[model samples]
Target chain A: MSDTLLRLIRHGQEQGCRPHQRYLLDRAQWATLVAALADMPEVALLGLWGDPGQVHAALLIEDGLLIASCGVPDGRFAAFSPVRPGAVLFERMIRDLWGFVAEGGTDQRPWLDHGRWPVTGPLAANPAPNGMAPPQPVFLPVEGEGVHQIPVGPVHAGIIEPGHFRFHVQGETVVRLEARLGYLHKGQIGLMLGKPAPVAARFAARLSGDSTVAHGWAFAQGVEAALGITPSPRALALRALMAELERLHNHLNDWGFLCNDASFAWLHARAGALREAVLRAANTAFGHRLMMDRVVPGGVSDDLRPGGDAAIRAALAMVAAELPALEAVYDSHASLQDRMVGTGVITPALAMLFAAGGVVGRASGRGFDARRRPGYAPYAPAEAAVLTAGDVDARARIRLAEMHRSVALAKGLLESLPPGELLVPLPQRGGEGLGLVEGFRGECLHWVALDDEGLVRAVFPRDPSWLHWPLLEAAIEGNIVADFPLINKSVNASYSGVDL
Target chain B: MQGWRRLLWPRLAQGLVSAPLTDPPPVPPEEVVQALVARLEAAAQTRLGRSLAIRQVDAGSCNGCELEINAMQNVVHDLERFGLRFVASPRHADVLLVTGPLTRNMREALLRTAECMPEPKWVVAAGDCAVDGGSFKDSYAVEGGIDAALPVDLLIPGCPPTPTQLLEGMLALIEAQRAGG
Candidate 1:
């Protein structure tokens, strides 16, 4: 254990969690941990979620991942949001779902419960009927001359997921942009409980539809870890292959849309074609375009079909061939550059402060890819692309770099493909485990606690969007109103993932 | 002078001659397109050449359906060429293409959108969730299906219907509307 875990354990007892250490803290210890968060800027708060009787916080120290759990005996606990800004929304979500109040919390507003759920705190020990009329959402007031507010969506103009954005602006210049999400919440965590791990993995795949493969693999890894099962080498390589293909398709889609938002229709067209090709190849290889539900507990559900490797390589080659010309157009286009460069800048300090992951963090000079740390099998340690600018252009550049790397990685996995059994049977025993993977957007973390019968007792799927969404609010602080869409596309935070 | 010359000449010439990458609709057979086109044309004859204008509503989807729906606009799918285009507001729409299981938080928004659409509007439920809360039926937040909240005219079912299936559904929707009227 590291010094941080040792300090955390002094006030609590460590639980028998596989692959990671989880400590159960009392109220006093919880309060101490909350207080220490202010002084420990080096520690990143990975995830914060709650169950009926207790709350758990996943923390990343210099050495490894540590989970700190605190009992909510009185339905209240010390809030970490006062010191950790990233904990504010997580604390709110805990309140809305498990009915636990974060004592001395900075924000008291409801997060996912827009006051319209059938029951209040549906995951609470005793959920009650919610008959109260929903209240109008409130945004933080911005006071300045000529300042006005512009509210967009739970329904947007284009075909997209639903979420609200409140912009405070002064003569076309944005002062602050706050996102109001949770329109897609469907009790994901509540639905996963009590089901078998394989059955529950379906919900994980849908946490964010675009990240189905990554989320599925992460959830599967957690279950396998709990059972102390290692899948066949072929299964591990197949999972990586699916994940890389998913990354390719999604990044191509986003890159196209980013350019389209900048009014560069030509690049959008080319990128869209390439994305379609990638999706087609993925469908041929995995029998599903998005590869949903193909990855389950213990191992992957299917092996690669004959010529699957060739299909994937052909798609990759097409993309590779088009890259030089596509990049030249993007680099030379003055209008696109004007819209992207210096717009929606999330400073390196702010990125570090929030512990932002994925492209958003990497673009801001924080290099943290979950695949490289606490990593699983069939993957070589890879260097994440880091850019210091932290602007929309830097993010776009990062996506381009990641796509190239994904191509290489996918090909490498194909060459080293091994032959073996596809899955290992999971033991029917109780355990707790954590799974972390690098999805297209960033790190996707999932935690699962299984009962004696191998049924899911509690599960939390933490999307990387949780960290990037707040960074987006800060990124759009000073940008012009007209540039909001372009800025938003660059971040492209998932509403459904964060809503759950 | 040199910068301006380099910027405009080579790139402009290269862009002009780039062959189109769009392929014809790969599914739903050409006959379906012709039949739908014939129906649309007949309908247009009666309604001053108005094609189908749709407004998409994401009641509470996982966004997988939305991606396929968006792909309809891409070159390969090219749904707009079939005379169906997505509009910004429900008031301007002839159909409400709804996806996802109807969540309690979004039930009112979905209703308001359907109500705002001009009279003689059709509601097409796309995806397994919107048709009947596919994998999320037991959850407390979901209404199970769009039919629970609104009258669904057509149901296109899959975890998320492919772009080609979505187009076929749209065609069937228009044909159904014509025959029913």
Candidate 2:
């Protein structure tokens, strides 16, 4: 929180289906941004989210953070300017998608999208899919001693999401790294406009399949706020339980991947098995292994039917029994330790600049977790504890720490199962609302607006992945290409979630 | 053909997997069978209650629907018990659950997925994105809703619709067959 002061800065109405006309900073004002950052000691972040196709930028100063994002007429966005050199890319995305010009951004070439798209941006009001093919990617040449540029993905050897990685190497030491994503951009937010909230919430959950609970909860919170509905206390606790379950499950998987990446097969297999067991518990408690349809606005869709608890408890108990052994492997495995210890190191300063959160930030020594900070619902002040270190090892450790924390939360909820309605009815008169859910990733924000007809005016799932993706790109420096997987998994930001 | 092999092999092989505790006779076609009727509607075929084999396409979905879709195939609700299973390839699929709106990047892929599904294929736009491009409508690389690119059989709305609803939608597709698709 250095010069960044964290404050409860109230945000203005988040309009949908349209945005505020424009935010034109005069030359003096543009220069004043650097001055403003220096002047405000309590600014948490200089947040900027831009609509890749729109001409206007959504500029707001919250606490000391200067946020700059672009907006479509619908008030949603294509990409956000997360950190330095973002404006250049934002401008380029705008140019490629909307044919708009960013007044001052220098690098105006295509970023995630190619411009041969005869139609306007992907989410443009009118588009013809049959318009034209996209342009080919241009590879930037590497011209320095020992600085050979090697391009990696857009497609990988394994079954995973798509992304392109360019590494500048000095005989295996990565000097500079570049990542290009958007292969997964499925315009979900724009499609939500005009749809009923329940119908839209399901799409939100898929923003990242891995963080289904968090995304669903965040979207539900926004709709609930719009209708002024609070879930029954029992329902609230259930939501919290499910969220924590998801967190635990995800952490376990990451640990497994981290171990496997380090060639620690025993730990990987054990962790994967444990994760599989946890998912089984999830299926027994909620009807699905991933618990997808369970968390909705007001409350969950399913309750613990008879025999649900015992089965889940059995799985939880087994996981608890295995923790000590799991920790032993984590502590004793030399190769895993070597690969994870100091690789992909994000110093405390850079993590803050990039607004890294969740285990990624926690591992690096930055101590902000929405569950502890903003204090929402069942996770309010009482049960919110965060561990911060700011390193790859610290991140892995924090993930482990969070799993234990999740188990504790689950136990607390089950012991005092509240009896009442699961979900509350949404109020008829809908308005603007925002929800902040502490997902496995971090703060998953859903900014929503409802028309008089109860249709979604606009929905922006400001997933934590957006903030963490840049952090991954930064972390890849000074490491070999092979170590990338473990380091990348350390901050496993979801591409589909953020691209939308 | 594999279809006949898949059909005959299961019933032919049932005795090998079944124990005395789990042997139940298949109902005769003449018995009360609206569920079967629904199947005819679901697949545009005369036979009702045929096991539904679905092929799922990401086509740029956010992955919410994929999770629920995956959940439906798991043990809890056990969609498989209700005669539903997901096939890895589209050649065997009767229903296509498409997520995400058609992105410029994924338009060809999305159309290719739809084309790959055999005739009488039904497309269920699982999330808002597939239904109408969800929240990412106007960006440069996206093409709007999935239906704009393919003929849709049903619109199961949600940011990502719940598993129950998705199950219901698949069931509805079967029912549609009886009702005359």
Candidate 3:
């Protein structure tokens, strides 16, 4: 793991106007902005082609953000990539959804918006990507030398969601891999337009269930940003608590998978059981295990009830005590160690280039935690728990470490419970909002604009996987094809988050 | 004829046999429907779209669902298949599936197959550490699920949904949409 430098480089601030008083970057600007970011030496990169100009898009965490402008008609401008080796898939999205030209980009065809969608505009002008436009399946080209192609589903043997992966392999060795996603595009962005803030939040959280906190907060950021209201300290603290709780639960499950994949059945089962206990505690405390509907525009929808607090305390103590043994099981099992130790290794240099977050980079020895990166709240109370391993084993270790860290934070939040109004009071109208939550996966940046009546105008939440998806493609390059399952499980990037 | 050890071990079972077990929670979709009719009709959005049964697909997630999915279905507040049934396939499903990293193995199958369901299909990703690869977000073999496939309807936040909470999301979707298709 070498010392490599990669930082977000912003070009400018995009504006998001009134009603939804937020500004965003145009598709062209976003490309230039990322191009500047792509300058990090020794990087593998791709950029997105999102048409927010017609609809007021913004770059909240980086350069500029623009929101609440009119929608752009489909198929208008041609896509341009000022950077060398521009992304072909991005060009596909621009052409298919926005009906723009993607000049000289590879595979310039539909990516997500497969003709079945009822509406196919990017909502730059229409407020929807072609309202409920159904997608017609568009095939992708499989290329390589002496390549025999094998295609595995959108539906799966494990009964998971649908997605197509084409493996262009020579014998058993994979020469090239292409991921075809967005079989599940449901036009939520279109549906959110004109919906009340609270109503829209559900859609946000639903965008990717694992991203509930990020999407909810991102949507809330838009509403609150529109109203120019800040979350109460207590509200912010609670939001942090729930978000971390979500992170801990997710990490525990991932650790369990690592063990399971390596055939450490008992360790896997224990992790699984412990994760369930956390959910049980959540159900006891928040009334919903996943905490859906718990977050609203102003603040959280639920607070710690007296009994619930006690239940959580008990659960935390148990988890904190139980985690060490679980780690021991993972460490002690020789087979588990062998299976995980060096599988799917992502070097520090590569990690820096990709700028990946969560456990992937941490394991690869790149210490980038969103809580630490921009320095957000509650987490500000404590330091970001960063571990640099950069390997499957490293990622697993990070998951174990993060679980312990989550327990400590959960305990701290409970002990320092703040007494205040749960919801912020709001007037009848508009304002701009920007929300950046350190979701379990990593950074979830959301920018929103509201109408005069607090209705949602445009909501754009960027999931951490947006950055990590390509990195996943790179990390698996030299690894044996069979080791892919373990490696893929360890990286766990989100398609829905990136697709949205 | 039994020794004391045998008597103690066998006797313990016989002693415990006096109590009858509570019948298992009704699993038949019909039985669950019959029981939830009231809860659904009462707490349900008086609106037609207020009740929904969302089935989550394991796709390829680590069996984290043994708890999370169970949380959505079991004891404290069991969300029976009532308005939210967990159908095995997409054909009968109204809302779409969940969990993933789409896996080296599951990629193409998950896609061409998910669309077979009737229109107005929606998806819900239920965990942190799930199907868009969760911790496995970087695996090259994984295609990522949920949002990558079809439009996800909602996401139930957590590594797994507490049974009661997942129920809330199903309710919210049904209530908000007021129509499955």
Which ten contiguous residues of candidate 3 chain A have the minimum total lDDT? A1-10
Ranking by DockQ: 1, 2, 3
Off by over 4 Å in 3: A1-91, A102-107, A122-146, A381-389, B1-67, B70-181
- Tens-digit per-residue lDDT, A265-380, candidate 2: 66766776666678768878887777886888778888886677886777778778897779976897686777778788877776665556677767766666767655577775
Give the per-prediction TM-score of chain B: 0.76, 0.71, 0.62
Name the weakest run of 10 consecutive residues (lDDT summed) in model 3 chain B.
Answer: B20-29
Instruction: Identify the superior model by TM-score, candidate 1 or candidate 2.
Output: 1
Cα deviation of A141, candidate 3, in Å? 5.8
- Alpha-carbon interface RMSD for all candidates, in angstroms: 0.8, 5.1, 10.6
For each candidate in turn, the TM-score is 0.94, 0.71, 0.71
Estimate the TM-score for candidate 1: 0.94
Summing lDDT over every window of 10 consecutive residues in candidate 1 chain A, give the lowest-scoring window: A1-10
Q: List the DockQ of the predictions in order.
A: 0.74, 0.19, 0.08
Recovered fraction of real interface contacts per model = 0.76, 0.37, 0.08
Residue A139, candidate 1: C-alpha displacement in angstroms: 1.8
Q: Write the residue-wise lDDT of candidate 3 on A246-348 in tens digits.
A: 8877887777776777777667666666666676677688886667668888888878755778777777777788888777667776878888887777777
Best-matching candidate per lDDT = 1
Give the alpha carbon lDDT tens digit for every residue of B1-181 in model 3: 4556855788588878765222233322333334334444444423344344344555555334434564343333445534666665667666664664444344344555566666545566766544355544433323454566555545655655445555655665554553312
Real contacts retained, model 1: 0.76
Which candidate do you rate higher for lDDT, 1 or 2?
A: 1
